[model samples]
Target: MIRALLDPSEGEPVQIERAGGRSPVILVCEHASRTIPASLSNLGVKPDTLTSHAAWDIGALATAQKISQLLDAPLVHQRFSRLVYDCNRPPEAPDAIPEMSEIHAIPGNRNLSGEARQQRVAEIYEPFRQALAALVAARTGPSRQPVIVTIHSYTRVYFGAARHRAIGLLHDRDRRLADTMLQQAEEHGITNAMRNYPYGPDDGVTHTLRLHAVQNGLLNVMIEYCSDLIDTEKGQDEWAALTTRLLEAALERFDIHAAGSQQA
Candidate 1:
């Protein structure tokens, strides 16, 4: 029998915020939590390392939460550390259970048995993806499709180099939504917003977009905020308010509307 990676008392692996929201936009935060199950023993890494960006996107969840509230959009976020199983990555990707993230090596992920990998996927990844799919399907239809937006954050300094971009708008083959958001950011005096800065679709960070948005022929985009900029509640609020405005403007500018009847 395969041992369960997540215990019943550990709480649900997926955190759905505003599940019944009526907005046409669906928000996803794959690296929202840094909680490692007690069974993994912090994945053999130092306790402090679990608090770092390698474990989770520091301010991405808070910012995402603010955006969800501002837009009244349903948000689906993972409750486990990305180090356990990166929901945004395809299972075949080595980094899904990374042995090394930046300069920090993860001892637990090293030389894992096939069953170990499968357990994580079964417990953490599939449920989140399914929930997101169901959420999107319920809101989308033949006449219209809901927009998919993922929120993420990048470190200001990576591999000893400083990154100056404050915001990054990433996309794959389809740039429809990203292009419009970038234009709006620039017009709103937010010049730090760049297309595919820090990381892009080519970096294998677009799995969620590829699986849900691109494959399903829906408009989608990923926004990356500099972790330092939105690290605090005040900062999250400011960025969220700004992002909400830009998002609303983009939707109106593109004449996009909720596909089905709006739900509370």
Candidate 2:
């Protein structure tokens, strides 16, 4: 028998907070945890690499949770490391189980068999995908329309090159929410915001947005916070407040009700 990716004691792969939240906004943090399944033995990575951006999006979960609290929105996050499955990516994507993330090479992923890859997909990605899908579906009727907002954080420097942007509002073909957020950032005194600076759809970074939001014709946007900016509780709270304001502004711009119903 193939060694299982997740043990019986490992708990569920997807974590949903405020599942019954009244807000129509559904927040997602795909790279929330740096936890590798004990079966994977840390994927043979170094101690520091195990906690680095390659393993998870630093500060993203805390920021997302804060946004969820501020908006009374529901949050769905993955419990396993992105190096294990990359919940944002589809099963066929090349980097879904990356062999290398930036300068750190993933030793266990180097020679993964078909079964190993499939195991990660079945054990890690599927649960996260299904939970998020179910949440969206539940909010997708005439009475309520859900918004998809995925949160993430990026490193100050990657491969020795520094990233200057403090925040990023990314979107795919549908730029409705992202555009409005960017426009409102300056008004909120957040002048360092940029459009698709750190990563874009071309980089396959918008998988969650494309799959859950664009395909469903729902309003959506991906928010990227610089790691250094949201690395503390104060920073998380500050960014969360900013995100809540921007989301409210965008919803109002679209005439979406706070109760999640369309004005019509």
Q: What are the lDDT figures for the candidates, one per model?
A: 0.88, 0.90
RMSD of each: 2.1, 2.4
- Model 1, runs deviating above 4 Å: 257-264
Which candidate wins on TM-score? 2
* lDDT digits (tens) for residues 203-229 of candidate 2: 999999998999999999999999999
Best by lDDT: 2
- Runs off by more than 4 Å, candidate 2: 258-264
What's the CA error at residue 21 for candidate 2, in Å? 0.5
TM-score, prediction 1: 0.95
| Clash number for candidate 1 | 0
TM-scores for all candidates: the values are 0.95, 0.96
